[model samples]
Target: MHGRIRTWGPGALVLLPTVLLLGYFVYGLIAWTFNTSLTDKHNARPVPTNHVGFENYVNLFGEERFLNSLKNLGVLTVAFIVGTLIFGLIWALLLEKGVPGEGIFRSVFLFPMAVSMIASGVVWGWLLNPSQGDDARGLNRLFSILHLNFLENPWWTGGSRWTTMASIALPAVWQLSGYIMALFLAGFRGIPPELREAARVDGASEFKLYRYVLFPQLSPIALSALIILGHMSLKLFDLIYAITGPNQFRTEVPSVYMWNTLLRSDMAKAAAIAIVLLAVVAVLVIPYVAYTVRQENEE
Candidate 1:
């Protein structure tokens, strides 16, 4: 045991500080928040209250706005994940095939990612504005030119909640899909040329080759992408907050809702909502992590 320790001690010592730092910085805060959520303390007020059990959580669930925010989050998560993955995969595939002006196309697609989320939101908001007449800009003008003026309703109007939700999601996809494409492209490029050559030699059609040969190998990459995309969707805030104002019910997400709660001096309820959001992410990720660990052990 002493000999084994001597051999591994140097590496272990090197990692100790990093592990400690992560625990202190990340895990410690999570623990603190968890404890806070169990209390009925209002941070904005003078006196800190005592433990209140799950009353905050009950209150959170009882609120219609909170429920609506959760529903909005669910819709955004599904739409963003599907849209980004499909669009990213297609972009990656095209780039891998050496399409015309591939470099330019890649730059154009990725440029959105380089901009700040707030900037992206601002740009997209302008582009989606639904005002009409000579002063019409963005989608409104294009629709008017095509005599499709019916599509020019104010995107942020309270009456069209679904349209507003979709508008926010579109910008999110546009900004994030490029990053997803980069990940897919990296995975695609790592594939051995010999495998493609062999498949071609066996007279495999392009579609069949991709469906049977390529996709199976891309599982790990896909899983990685899902994990990243899932986390982003779960914690989504900046774009939604920027594009739609804080009070906008139509575009409310968990993060924005949490912010609103905090602003409204509902710290305990905000903490409860945050804990719920954390649990949701854990429920989604923990299984995948456990499966990966099992596979690694089996290997």
Candidate 2:
């Protein structure tokens, strides 16, 4: 016992504060939110003594607005993840070939990520403004100037709700694609040159080399990026809110809906939405975390 304490005592003491803080602020709040969701509490009855037991969740899933939000979330996730991965991979590929001014290009690509999502959303909000005719501005004006009028459309305010949500994902893709590029680029560089040489010696072409040799090794990095982006999509809020505002059902996600619900003092409903979002993020993240831990242990 004395020997174990001597070895582990300082590390345990150092970790104690962080463990307590995380337990209370993070996990504890999650528990409190879950408890609140199991209640009949709102502005009318601020006290949550009435334990409803998942009634809020049941009603939330049945609501048309919430269902639409989930649909929108699905559309945004698919678009955002696909767009970012494709673009990031392209950028990384170009950089990996030793392009001129690689450092400058990499920084330029990554600069958008340094800007906050809200700022990017505000700028993109103007760029993707649905207005046309005499009131045309932003991309509409640019389209007119370039005579690319065919490219101009109502963007996120389009009639099709799923299309609108997918369009809203463009800004998110722009902001995060660079980070994905960095991930892929790091993965590419971490690969041993011997692997490439050996593949070439085996008569593999450039395309075949990447398709069979490089990409397979990058699978772990891609999976990690997918999980990270998946959770971000699940909790998406600030960008959508900044672009379309809270009332736009076409682009509304659960996080924005939760905020709006909270504003109306619908505490139970909002907590239910938050818990649902948390559960979704966990579903994406936890599996990846387990896989990572298992890989670490095997190594």
Candidate 3:
């Protein structure tokens, strides 16, 4: 007991300041937000006598823009997750087959993730710009060259909300799929070679082997990836803001809406929206995390 305590002493002392700082920064911010959400106070003026009890939440639910933003968030989250997972799995499989120039391919895929989302958004925005030229020197040009004229619609300028949403989702997928692929590749590599060889020797088809043998092993990693991607989709802000600006109805995600409300002096509404967003993520993520932990313990 004495030796163990001595061994931990230095580590505990080192971690004390870090723990305190994290609590002050993270827990402190959350508590402050909770307090502000309950009040009807503006930045310049304090509403000392006007303590609104969930009035802001009621008002927030009544707003059409808030409702629309929530809908968009749902759409974005689902599409982003599905798209990234599918693409990531495909990328991982391709890489696993020992392709030539594997390093270059991996780097190319991950380079987008290394770039800031804001910068990627700006670049994508330019590439999708509708008013470029008659040749439509962006997405339009590429579509025209490929004889896919239907896809040449002015994604940025046109009033087609779905088109705009798809455009935004494309860049997000490009940036995120690489990270997902890395996770899946690591999971795939951890599988025993003997198991795969034995499956093949037993006349199991490649597809069957992957489905029955490999997928179950990957569940924990996949679940973790899902939780992370879901949280990211829930609080997505930088990309949307950079690509569509804060005021645009077509690209207003929940986070963007919350920002607008907070910056525009609707503190109560902002806080209400923020709380709702947090609750949504918690509902989706908490169960999965608990399940993962339980599975880990069982294993």
- Highest lDDT scorer: 2
Q: Give TM per candidate.
A: 0.90, 0.96, 0.90
Residue 13 error for model 2, in Å? 1.0
Instruction: Note each model's CA RMSD in angstroms.
Output: 2.3, 1.4, 2.5
- Sorted by lDDT (best first), the order is 2, 1, 3
Deviation from native of the Cα of residue 273 in model 1, angstroms:
1.4
lDDT of 2 by residue, 170-216 (tens): 88898899999999999999999999999999999999999999999
Clashing pairs for model 3 are: none
The models' CA-based lDDT, in order, is 0.85, 0.90, 0.83
- Per-residue CA lDDT of model 3 for 93-156, tens digit only, reads 8997879998888888888899899998888887887753455777778887888777777774
Find the 10 residues in a row with the least total lDDT in model 3.
41-50
Residue-wise lDDT of candidate 1 within 1-299, one digit each (tens)? Answer: 99999999999999999999999888887887777888887677778579988888888889899898898888788888988999999999989998989889988999988889888887777887767777789988988899997777676554555666767788889988999998899898999989999999999999999998888889899998898888888898988877877888878888898898889887777888889999999988998899899999999
Alpha carbon deviation, residue 163, candidate 1 (Å) = 3.0
Candidate 1 wrongly placed segments (more than 4 Å): 1-4, 133-135, 146-153, 156-162
**Best candidate, TM-score:** 2
Backbone atom clashes (below 3 Å) for every candidate: 0, 0, 0
